[model samples]
Target chain A: MQIMVNGTTHEVDVEEDMPLLWVLRDELGITGPKYGCGIAQCGACTVHVDGVAVRSCQLAAGDVDGEVTTIEGLGTPDALHAVQEAWIEHQVAQCGYCQSGQIMAAASFLETNPEPTDDDIDRAMSANLCRCGTYPRIREAVRSAATKLMEA
Target chain B: MKAKTLAVAALIAATATTWAAGETATTTAETEAPSVSVADGLEAWSRIYEVASHPRCSNCHVGESGIPMWSGPSYGKTRPHGMNIAAGESRIGAEFVTCATCHTRSTQGNTVAHAAPRVDMDWQLAPAQADWFGRTSQEICSQLRDPERNGGRTAQDIAEHLDHDLILHWAWDPGGGREPAPYSLQEHIADVMAWGMAGMPCPNG
Candidate 1:
């Protein structure tokens, strides 16, 4: 089947039940989305499918119904998305294993809630687990990203 | 099909014996139950109740909490579904991560240990009005007989729904090391039909 990932459409031959994370990491060689947990419990495999955040590890390849966007597609190194810029500004990464998913989730959350409160940010980002305990910085980065998005 | 026919025949014989034994009619004056004795209907309903209240069915039949439960012996301890999952008002988890993200639709049987349960139908929680989780048998019986909370479906309609609904079938044949609901699907359907024919009698009535 043909799937578009990060602005590139590629034909992939795989089993129907294979998770999208496997397709992205194994087939397409896009490892931005980490596989913290194969189950949906961990949001380390979060990505945007038509701008809606979904856990790639649990999403079946055949079930993908829209354009896929990983952290690679979220922004370029030269022109980072507001969430990415905020991450650097606030130093939200501790070990950085979960940073890509955190940024992706934050970007998607800010899209629907551009002016989120602290509680809102906490509730939204709570799904993505960070073992390094970088939540304070993650919250600050989300707040900063919301400000940057508003300014733009 | 044969099992259902035999169960219904047995129910009829039981109803006849109860009537012959001078069983006082248990249904209220307004009850729509036919010739079947209230005693027999309630007996049949007891079986249906077993299946309805089991964790396989009631876990998703939640209330306003919008949180489906993960209970039964398989889960070890009765708790809210992990990961703070909420079905929201949509009942399909549309506002956040859709239930389809994990519970994918599939015709194949569930053999994966500890994987999210899968069925041939779209994954979703029962409507809030039909909430049955942690409810008593009497409450579920009343709700099943009432048209409003039961999706405006009469007892016969409810019986047919139990007969053919794929999700309902999942309750009886749930794989993944989960305990199937009590009694076979055919027996459940027969009991439901017999109960409906008996005017959908509630336990109290």
Candidate 2:
């Protein structure tokens, strides 16, 4: 199978039913998307598909056949994305298992909702559970990123 | 005139007592099930209670940032979760102190001066909305059924949501201080479905 991740194309062989998360972590060795829960509950495996954040754990390999982006793909250490910066500014992570998911969810949220209110953030990010209880940071990151992204 | 005033006072007292009784009834109803059969409902009650009372539910159920009285301040505020040292949004702070700096994915319990540090399985914090605590099952049920309110899901979508969505499944995987729900995810869904199928009943009783 041929899959594109973060703009690079890779060819691999695996079960069609294999979860995108497993394929990424095991076959491709793209371990950025961690596996907190095989189910999408933890949002720890959140990644971007064509710019939309999705739970890679719940998505089948056959399902996400397009461009997939993990946390590594989002930005670089030297040139960090605004969301990453905002996450730092807001101190969003606690346990850090769910930060990738929180970041992915925030990124996806900002794409459409460039400027979100508290309620909008709640409704959008509710699906992405942060067990570390970094929700306040998630919201703050979203707000800060929105401002930063809009400025950019 | 005095006799008439006394009569009106007695009527007023009776009305006030009725109002007080009504308030008490609501309080009981709020704590107990909306109906009678829920006595065997301990399992069901606990499942709902766990989900409702868990940090995921309690944190959001409590208060947002900048409230007069914060529910759990151990996380931080200006830092989005304020405390000892703050990480901006990046999890890594201004000095490049990432959330991973202290809060690694796993911990036994990292202690903070003002508040205790989380050290359980993936201990961190539920998002800001977690402050919304002490919700009744029926209220959560209603929230789950409403697409506009419940994360943009429809009635049928809710069934799929429960089936496929994982965080909902986390009630069964609550680690450390938190235990999994008394009932399996399927059973909770079934009860939720029963209510959903019954037109998402809210307790008038």
> Number of the top candidate by DockQ?
1
Our model 2 lands, by Cα RMSD against the true structure, at 17.0
Q: Estimate each model's TM-score.
A: 0.80, 0.44
lDDT of 1 by residue, B1-205 (tens): 2333222433222222122111222111112334656777888888888888899999999998788999998999999988677777788765544576567666655666677776656689988988899999899999888887888987667755664456777777677788999887657766777787777888888
- Predictions in order: chain A TM-score: 0.99, 0.94
- Model 2: per-residue lDDT, tens digit, B1-205? 1112111111211111121111111010012123323222333333445555654335423333322122333333312232222222322332212232223222222122322122222222233332335567655555555556666754435544545433444445434334344555445544443344335544422
In terms of TM-score, how similar is model 2 to the real structure? 0.44
What lDDT score is found at residue B73 in candidate 1?
88
Error of 1 at B29 (Å): 28
lDDT of 2 by residue, A62-149 (tens): 5454699999999899988889999888888888877887787778768766877776676556656777777787887888898999
iRMSD, per candidate, in listed order: 3.1, 14.9
Model 1 pairs in collision: B33-B198, B33-B199
For model 1, what is the C-alpha lDDT against the true structure?
Answer: 0.78
